[model samples]
Target: MARKLPELKRRKPSIAEQQRFILICEGEKTEIAYFKALKAQYRSAQISIEYVAPAGVPITIMDKVKARMAELRREQRSNPSVKADTVWAVFDRDEHHKVTEAIAGRQVSGAQVAYSNPCFEVWLVLHHEDYHASDDHHQVQKRYQKLDRAYDPDGSKTPDCGFLMNRVEEAENRGERQCKSREDEGMPFGRPSTTVYNLTRAIRAAAEASRPKRS
Candidate 1:
């Protein structure tokens, strides 16, 4: 018999095949730090996370996110398998009128927006206790002060700040209740609502799903 053909080498799957979460945020550091913390806490190794910030105001953030994702997809044509599995935008409803437009407008390339009414600090405050008052971001900061006097608005979180990561589940429950209440009522945009919790839940689910089986 002729010599056996040389064994063919199999190409292993590259890291590019892994699932990814693309995030565009309004803040440069706080949201980025928070997500980085969540990624670590959840040990989401299977899912790659890309966060883009300093992305301008709400509407601008949306535009940048869509444009960047489009560029990525165009470059990824060589390997369609390498692409963002999920895309999301995180922004606060502070004085930004464009926030509503960003929310109501059509999602770009199926990217979802996670907007916190008043401000994202509201979601952070919910970690300690439930709040439904229709106040602005400063008021939300006050609530946070009750839990941690050293809270900083410019994205400074000390070691104790890490505690918020532990109470994520509690925060999600509280936030969902508020979100449902807002939906039931006829409240408009920036009226004490937040979808940050939902985004967190989605990330958590993706992380769990990406985990390898024990067997």
Candidate 2:
């Protein structure tokens, strides 16, 4: 009697490119806008980013990301083929010890994390011309300089997420006055500005470069 050959167990093919996921601290409106822009800009093909709030401080956000990563690790163990390719935690370097603690914690946990330059405002410094300065500017002339000469030629613009945010507010104010008869207020945050898209693209490019390549 001829026995049928054992049916071959076909397995699903693995992904051709690695997938990436990141977590960034959620805080003020400007920071939120910058991250949103970054995600929108970089959102294509192989990478993904998400923003999560720790509800308190930068360290809290780090903890959340780490916990999420741990959960992902467990998921990968069961699937064997699926794994989180990257995890990053971003926050501002403002008047708090949180940024310092977050960095130190990541180093100790042996986890890979990412951060924005000069705090979350780094993106802001890149966009607006008036906010770029070698030193902080409190005056209204706002003689800000380009964040870096390399990124902005002719010394005309900085990423200035804050400026973008202010313009959004100005536009909203004008619209509100024009439509005084109507009560429907335009959102205070304004439309998702280009800063979100631009910064996100930068982060995506950076993440791709930083990811390990399989030989």
Best by lDDT: 1
lDDT for position 77 in model 1: 85
Regions more than 4 Å wrong, model 1: 1-17, 45-55, 154-161
* Candidate 2 RMSD to the real structure: 16.1
- Write the residue-wise lDDT of candidate 1 on 62-139 in tens digits: 776678667767767867667455667788888877666787653545677888988887887788888889998888
How many clashes in candidate 2? 17
Q: What is candidate 2's lDDT per residue for 34-78, written digit by digit as tens?
A: 545544544442444456644456687778777867777888898
What C-alpha lDDT, on a 0 to 100 scale, does residue 53 get in candidate 1? 44
List candidate 2 segments past 4 Å from native: 1-15, 45-49, 116-118, 128-215
lDDT of 2 at 71: 72
Please state the error at residue 18 of candidate 1 in Å.
3.6
